[model samples]
Target chain A: MECMTENGGYAAGCRENRRDRATMQSVIPDAIEVDDIAKQFGEVRALDGVSFGVARGTVLGLLGPNGAGKTTAVRILTTTMRPDRGRASVLGLDVDHDAQRVRESIGLAGQYAAVDESLTGSENLWMMGRLTHLSQSASRSRSKELLVRFGLDDAGDRQVKTYSGGMRRRLDLAAALVHRPSVLFLDEPTTGLDPRSRRGLWDVIGELVADGTTLLLTTQYLEEADRLADRIVVIDQGQVIAEGTSAQLKARIGTTIIEAVFADPASAEGARTLLAPLGELTDADDGRALSLQVNTGPRSIMDAVGALERAAIEPLTLAVREPTLDDVFLRLTGQRVE
Target chain B: MVPARARVRRLTLGWTVRDSLTVTKRNLLTLTRNPELVVFATIQPVLFVLMFRYVFGGAIQVPGEDYVNFLMPGIWAQAVVFGAVSTAVGLAEDLQSGLIERFRSLPMAPSAVLVGRTNADLVRDVFVIALMCVVGFLVGFRNQTDALAFLAALLLMLAFGYSMAWVFAVFGLRAPNAETAQAAAFPVMAVLVFASSAFVPTETMPGWLQVFADHQPVTAVVDAVRALVLGGPTASYVVTAVAWIVGIVVVFGTLAVVRYRRVT
Candidate 1:
């Protein structure tokens, strides 16, 4: 919220940055387009002119830290909340005017398990089916099938309150898919799940995407997004910071990394000055070791070692590796991707 | 073949009914599972009716064989009013459980939810009225108005019960939590109990209280039910009671719908 108070002179200086590209047209695409979406909670702008799109049959993961605008975007797309400024559409239908149609085309598994605890696992799905306007016989049949597919057939008769968290989450997912929606929305589905349950859900999502479900998943875990999403759109403070495939984003910074590990202190200072002209040197731990970013392959590592050897500086360990998405995020945002 | 649109409409209605019955069944199950709640829900009306009938029946005379007969209609209306709280409390529980948000995500009709809920409450309220009627009869009260009149009295009480539902539904929706709804129900119910002719004749009250008891909707409802079921009063009270039913229904019903949309 303090960002709003520091804007009088800073806004003018920001306008002078002329390097910002005119990327506004990208917000007007057809499948899922949001333009100038802004929302204010008192002095806090939850979404500050947020804009983005996701094409049909493509999985776009909305990635951000906690309290980011990812959930707000999903809420707007799911027709739960409307933006204060811009508009949003899902599958060519406006979220506000065509909310029913939008809801019909999308299935959402929200952050919490939304199932009724008193109802049996099968009854929960049957009740959802009834809400979807399915025939009684058809609803029963479909509910039974989803139960079997989700490996919940054995516990179909038990009340949901008796089930474990993983079982409940699985049943929740099955309930979301009962309508056979074309697009599925999952907002931090794995936020509270253990590792094994999360992996099981990952498999379920992988299968869903493989069989042609256009999934828009919002998650705080970069690894989950990387494993499940074909493309990720990183959002922070209600704006899209970056959007691309995993490999495409990693390529933003150079691919190769010359990581030098030191056994003890007092040796990395000599290595830093020796390799400073060849590449940017980052001290691994103050003066313990030296790491560098490079555009070339293992040749940079060899040159650094030759330079350090000529300078009579001894290094304990050296390695050449490719940078991960975490490194790419740090390079762009100047903070760890927490 | 029938058109797809027709199928969807038919299915939506089917779903609404199914959900409503499911909710009613759940409430009934709560009573059966914890039989103590059954006694607790009926205890207040039973206590109030007894206080008015046997405790005060001989002192304040109506032109009926037993003063208990005159008290039955007033008791019925009050019991039905108490029963409307179930709807509000049930809705508040659903809100607390996040079940309403689950329903919101589905392709369900917007109005179907409240409609189903209000309808289910109607059934539960009527059932509670029947139990009160049985209790009244066991205590030596007889209905001189016959079976047809009894049915008419029940329907009027149910209609009045149906109208009072709006007041609580609003509280339930705006209530930040389920406990808020439960806490707010008591004083409101007490106000209606005090203002109505549930205990004493409106003519015998003090001047200002008489005017209030006369103009109050609950008094009109109680007087009408008394005339129909016990049949000592003139036909005018029945006319006034139906008017009260319609008037409260129109105003509070609209308010309930508006508040529902606002809170949701």
Candidate 2:
């Protein structure tokens, strides 16, 4: 949670960085850069000229729904797959030309948990350590260290097939860190975890960021991106539709949502027409609820209630909230992120 | 001090060996955790031995030898070749589970996973073949030749099995899942194993059937091993068997490596 909270300050710092962005780009350097990278699989264009960069020691959330080319971008950046056009580099090394060296400095946890189920948790990590060229003793020690750090000490000797889904994810992340990689790519790291497990993973990832590990995290969950990422690059259908900080993305919608729910469709419809002049009506599901975006904030809330009252419409419930990332996503893509 | 290029070359070579062995140990450890994997691999052929030796023994005739004597080499060859199917199944399972993707992303040698898998499965094949040999003895089969010749036969069967491991590696990479790998491998292997001279000599067959039975790789290996262990001319069959083994290893080994590199 230290890094999670610190991220707000970090993002503010990044905003200040905007004034000197050009000079800072020359000095600090980007840990990962994708320049118009494109990839096609048979009839499907998985990535269509996508471009972005992650500054050193910052988290970049590649936010998108399924099949949006986030994993494709990650695969190209991690040196596991090649793009059909353009280029990418990691830590100043070309991903395609210096793939071996790139691999030595980076770690990746793919969408699927990739640890061997037949091997013990300790054995999986130890084997990864050995493959990364650690000595036998070093491998054993690192395995033990990571097992404890990830709260897998008691299950270290058990086969991974016996582990729960959340435990397997922790072990997978542990395996990726065994080599102390400088840059890490996690594709949908908490895609299938429960809320509690996802939050726990977020904390661990937050700690990693606090230690200055540059991370490229792809996720479908907007709250995950909002909570952890210093910057977000929202992609849809293999294209970057929006890129900004969480607050900035939310600000793009430029309004607060006023939702009024009535007991019946006729009353809801009545309220909609009465409240039309107050703001632009957006989503009113099944005609029983009405949602509108008003730019004046709290004053608009008073206006909406007064308008409804004058029309003799009794809303079963009414609430006002700032636009969430979900609202931004829906506004940008014309479809919900889910 | 070494030149920069040579130093990097030495490091790459060192890591290749180290990484491959690490993966090999990982696969072997799975066997220790689940001994039934080996037991089931051995038990299937043992059942074949019993079924063939007792039920078919009284019906079939070998010109100058007991049916068990001729059958033992065939059974050993069958067991070793069939053992190779696990290579395909194991690899397909790894691919399906995304473990292969993890390995590809690591700073290891490109061929390390394949090398580790085939080598470990070869070691398993050796164990299963040796156990089949003991089963052969218990069921009244004996080697007519000296100990050196017997050792040569065992080694030959192992090499043939190792080659088949590469062939199955291709099937594994092409298959989408473990079940598909097993399904594709077993039927093709069943045809190759049962249609060859492993079960009966081609001399008793029709001309067209004998042509296939006498010329296939499985038949060449079985005939070579049978000759080395059961007292017959050894040079030609051994050479032919070795040639087929080398050819298969070259072609399918290359194919498997290429498929592995392109695997998504």
Candidate 3:
């Protein structure tokens, strides 16, 4: 990125980015580059000036509430849907002008399994191979290999309608890889799976990234993002609310939460006033309890606890720990989501 | 390692057609596995031939004497049109199911997947058309047109079958769901099949309806098939029918391709 900058700073990276964009190399170290892209559906604006980028091979967790444009952005980058405004290129190919090439370079598993119910597991995989422009011999061979790898070889000859949901999702992912795309887009890949199966898929995704495939995953499950993503991006109403490494985003919300259980309303009132200086204090779920979120250190925690006890509110419990991604999402989007 | 031109051309018609054919073969295998669908898809066309040829065969008369000969051409056209619809429904289902989106991610030609699907539909329609002919023969229907003329009729119906697919393709893309696509296409299918001279001679119909039906392109197509199969006076209609088929191809073909671009 630096070599292209003769004037130093922006000039080098700017020139390289332009060259990379023109040549279709996608070598900006960022696997995805999104500018002010937005989309509208009838009266609703699905995406509103959303922009973010993910470096190569690093899983960027996409999180938002149900109506958020998480899936919409994934669809745009995967070349399945074109944005009405703003330009998006995956692997340096403009989605509109070079969709065919972009498609070849990226693999997408949408929110649902798009497998043909009539086709057998083997036939579905082979069909994907054929659709990917593979020869008869090559498609057949690749289908066989993927079937074995995905643990579907035993059910390969059975119809897809007969396969379980987990098996179907696995087959869908396998089919996406028939062409061996360097970039893989998964839109809520683990939505309906049981815990075991979801974990199984998580392992598969990790292995894929380890193999150098850059993955852009849109998931609502906070744990899925926390487990897989190198960096997490929180989007709400089609705009980036916040983005950072998982730790950085969490740190933004502060550490240490103090929980105090009051004997009555009188004690709870006093606890709130006593804990004011430690940090932000708020009423807990129950009317008799109050909690304080503060920085992670003994001075803060001890002082906060001492004040609460002195206020005649004998604490039920008190603890200090770092904030989770949920707090980060709440702080940025004004709404907490799973 | 290959040059850019060579790589892009690697996905051209020659290779894409091979891919399409292989995809069609796989789909055919999948369909054959579902014996129920194969039976269900072919049954309606066969029943149409049997019911119309025997029950209404004698009641309806052409300019020439024999009802069987007259019914043969009409039944063939009807069979081809009806048989092609299964492919349209299949395409709609694929769209709803995410199969088309999955296909878009591949390096294959966009036309290739649809072509493969059409190929399977054509194969299925051809077989169904032939079966209806057999059923037609059982009920005393016969084609007196020479072998070349009969071949011409088959070619016309086949071309019409493939061309009719574009209208349904648009529906399949635009419809919110597969079930809606199936429901919407049938009414249009019924209008064309009924509006044309598929069931009765346009001359025998009520005067105003006759004029409208006669001038319509489907009527020209039916007239060509009738002339080709039963040796009627439809030479001019055959020329007009070919032109009509071409026009439908261009118009609806554009719509289907445009709709595909929108969806993708």
Candidate 4:
């Protein structure tokens, strides 16, 4: 919880206007804290000095591309794998020294669904509950509750192999939640899922948060992080490149993009030169479109329009928009988040 | 309800055993649901019993005893050993499917996954062995010993089968996938079952091969069961069988747990 007092103060203050929000902030504490964890797999350094923390009841998105060590970090924090150096804790218990204690307070739903394919959905959850030391009656009742909650009531008695991808993912999540763990780790929970299923999982995650479970969610989807993360830490090539709220990260780009699609490539090139002084200009879509990063926000559109008028270059379309998380990622990591 | 903080400190040996049994129940449930697997598993040993009893029984002679009596113990030894390979295949599937990762994340004992899998497979070996015994009876195999001796023989077979399950449990965890597990298990199983007294008499083999075939674990188990079932000097063979079982369980069970800790 020491990390929470330091890292969560700013986010908590922003919500302090509401009485309930302030109470929640004061009541709960840091649920996960990872400090300079470094792990190496032979010649490849999977994680190097990666550090972050999640406040209780908040979602901290570990945003990175494939092999960026998001899953590695999640594994270390969940006590399923140990880091070669440094330390992590879940619910204030050391992951390495007090691994069993840490495990008792946390649940993990990995990238792939981990439910037994041969077992029915309810049976899978019940088995998980029993493993967590619930009594038989309690396990059964809890399994029933979870199956109903995950919208799998009708499919509860069917083998997991008979389930659709989405249903299986839901069952996996339900299995993790069997003991109502105080903290949860979801490593790309919706990776291969369709949009509808992804949204369904997001809703389930939202509900978990609402019930005050701290979550560490790792995903390559910028939009998923933007929608769900209270705070985000971007990792690339085994290092933390940036850490902030989604809006804060977006603000780091510090420019509005003014994009103008001209009728012809020559006009687009001409417009790029004309608007070069306003901001950085680059041709997109094989010179069919021009995008300029201007610091003047909407005013950049007016400037572009005025310049085009004087040049007698009537652009087909013009728009100005703020930089997105994608721009922030591209600026920081020199690659798209995906 | 216990507070979360309090529960974190409450891990006990009893809880570990309970959790392992829970995992065992889950595995056994799968067998019940997939009846085809059981049917296929039983079919292989029955085929072995029939092929050996009728096809090779007349040609291979054990002096002063019916061929069926001598062959049935060997079949039981081979059947349980083959049944143990399923433990490897099942564990490999669990590892490849990410179920092991799920279990690793739980607060349960780290040994539970291995213990549960081996325990379930032993139960399966017991059932398969009983079926094979009925098949043995139909093929003219008879037990001349008392009820207690027969019971001891059954227990010894199960104990040996459980140890073999651990041996293959190590192989299963090391295999990249279920198919590879099955492939890896077959050659070792073939050598142990075929080279030992489980098939042809060890005396009929060549000098060097006989030395190994007579001393190997499978031969010891087969000889012990044969003596118990056919009324012979049983004490020495029973001690040797127990010793083999204990040795296999210690060596391979430790190896399996070590591999489980290191696997992803």
How badly does each model clash, as a count of residue pairs? 0, 0, 1, 0
The superposed Cα distance between candidate 1 and the true structure at residue A136, in angstroms, equals 0.9
Q: Per-residue CA lDDT of candidate 4, range A201-296, in tens?
A: 987887898687878999999878876777889999899999987767877877888877888889888887888897898768777698888874
Which residue segments of model 2 deviate by more than 4 Å?
A1-26, A259-275, A281-291, A296-320, B1-11
Q: Model 4 TM-score?
A: 0.92
Among residues 3 or more apart in sequence or in different chains, the pairs in candidate 1 whose N, CA or C atoms overlap within 3 Å are none
lDDT of 3 at B124: 72
* Candidate 3 deviant stretches above 4 angstroms: A1-28, A258-292, A302-320, B1-10, B232-234
Report the lDDT tens digits of candidate 4 across residue range B56-82: 877988888888899988888888988
Docking class of 1: acceptable
Across B162-193, the per-residue lDDT of candidate 2 in tens digits comes to 99999999999999999999999998899889
Leading candidate by DockQ: 4
- lDDT score, candidate 4, position B192: 98
Q: Compose the digit string of candidate 3's lDDT tens values, residues A252-336.
A: 7767677767677777777777778779877778877877788876888878867765765675665555666777777887777
Q: Which candidate should be chosen as best, given lDDT against the real structure?
A: 2
lDDT of each: 0.74, 0.87, 0.76, 0.86
lDDT of 1 at A241: 86
Tens-digit per-residue lDDT, A1-338, candidate 1: 12111311112222222112112223434457677788777787788888877765567788887777887788788887777889887777788887777777778887777787767898888877777766688889999999998889999988888998888888888888887877788888888889899878877887787676778999988777766676688887777888886656777775577888665565676677678898877666556867788775667767877997898777677777566667866776677765
Candidate topping TM-score:
4
Residue ranges of candidate 1 with Cα displaced over 4 Å: A1-30, A41-44, A253-338, B1-40, B47-67, B203-209, B262-264
How far is A172's C-alpha from truth in model 2 (Å)? 0.7
Colliding residue pairs in candidate 3? A5-A12
| Native contacts kept, each candidate | 0.39, 0.72, 0.73, 0.72
